[model samples]
Target: MAQLGFEVRDLEIFASRTVADGTAAEIVHREHQTSVEVRDRDGLSFFVNTAEPLESDPAADGRLSVNMLWLTPDVPAAITDLSNIGARLLKTADNGHIADFAAKNSGKIMAHFAKTAAHGPLGFGYHGKVEELLERLLAAGIDAHLIDESYGRTLHITNPDFADQPSNPTGPTIWVNEEDQPDQYGYTAPSGTAPQAARLDRDSN
Candidate 1:
């Protein structure tokens, strides 16, 4: 998301894997997945697998999830990037602060974008079983919430070692969700529902 202001990481290390001949950012093609590691301004590194299936598993082939939702300084530019990729507009906030878009053929929202830089850069959802993952996190003494939704189970866990961010008072959170019946990231919101983008410190866990 270099276009959206996230910085690419470890470019030198992936020099041999660089495949984009003239692209601004170095697009690295790993053996099984074509991905580039990137970090937000907050130094949170996110592993971005582009287009291809993250793993060689057949079940996950051609599917990608909307794992991270970020707040951008520029919303229109972000919209251009998504629009260039032909992402479908799923929802948008009335006051134009938030928008959710999903890639073609994918069940989950590809990315959630917010206009203001006041808060967040929040992320949510996991590719696997949330209940099992939550249990493990709880065992490790992490602060987490396990919420059962009509579609599946979800967990909201507080980010560790990052409690001092003023913009993110409650620190950032990592959301995990169980796979829905369709086997893709099947969480869907009914059209016209207000976008309840998570806040920094408002923990209902």
Candidate 2:
């Protein structure tokens, strides 16, 4: 979100989707590929892209799983703080692996998604409190998008100031929450646990 600091790719200047006058209105952002960037407190960042459901069937929704984890010296504490604001902890990092601490791993890091969305036998619909989860990132100057997945919204955070944005002295650690049980995007959940955020380079398939 340009308003929040996350580099909103192809974001319309006047409006995200449209611009209108008293009697005139038009679509300013005519279907730009939705994308964005998210950064952590230490200044490291990652990119995310918009996604759609695997099934054409409306009843079939999807969920997201962690592909890799990014870590920092203070990641556990940082993420715990995030949980208080929003990133509701489904599972703590107890299940994930930890990477060696170093300069490259000094900054905050998060899991890279492997399967962003998971379809299920019965795709029941439920509202996940998506906005609340990523709202904290706003304070960190990292704007994120609640991508439309039909059933709900999915996050697609990219580096907004990646190449030129000023360094943020303070930014929150934000992670993408993709779920199949309830739906994707827009915070709300089945109370699944999340692994501790870690550095991806240290992780192996």
Who wins the TM-score comparison? 1
- Runs of candidate 1 exceeding 4 Å displacement: 1-66, 70-81, 86-120, 149-153, 164-172, 178-205
Model 1: lDDT equals 0.45
| All candidates: TM-score | 0.40, 0.25
Superposition TM-score, candidate 1 onto the true structure: 0.40
Q: Cα RMSD to native, each candidate?
A: 11.9, 20.0
Query: Worst ten-residue run, lDDT, model 1?
Result: 196-205
Q: After superposition, which runs of candidate 2 have C-alpha atoms over 4 Å from their true positions?
A: 1-32, 56-66, 77-86, 93-205
Q: Write the per-residue lDDT of candidate 2 for residues 1-205, one digit (tens) a residue.
A: 1111112223232122212211111222225644433334433343333333344556532322232343344444335322311232333333332211111111222322222211111111112455654575566777676666554355545555444633422123223534333432333222454323332221111
lDDT score at residue 181, model 1, on the 0-100 scale: 33
Model 1, 16-124: lDDT tens digits are: 2222221122345778755554333332333444333334567642322444354566555544443333344555544455556643333333343443432234444
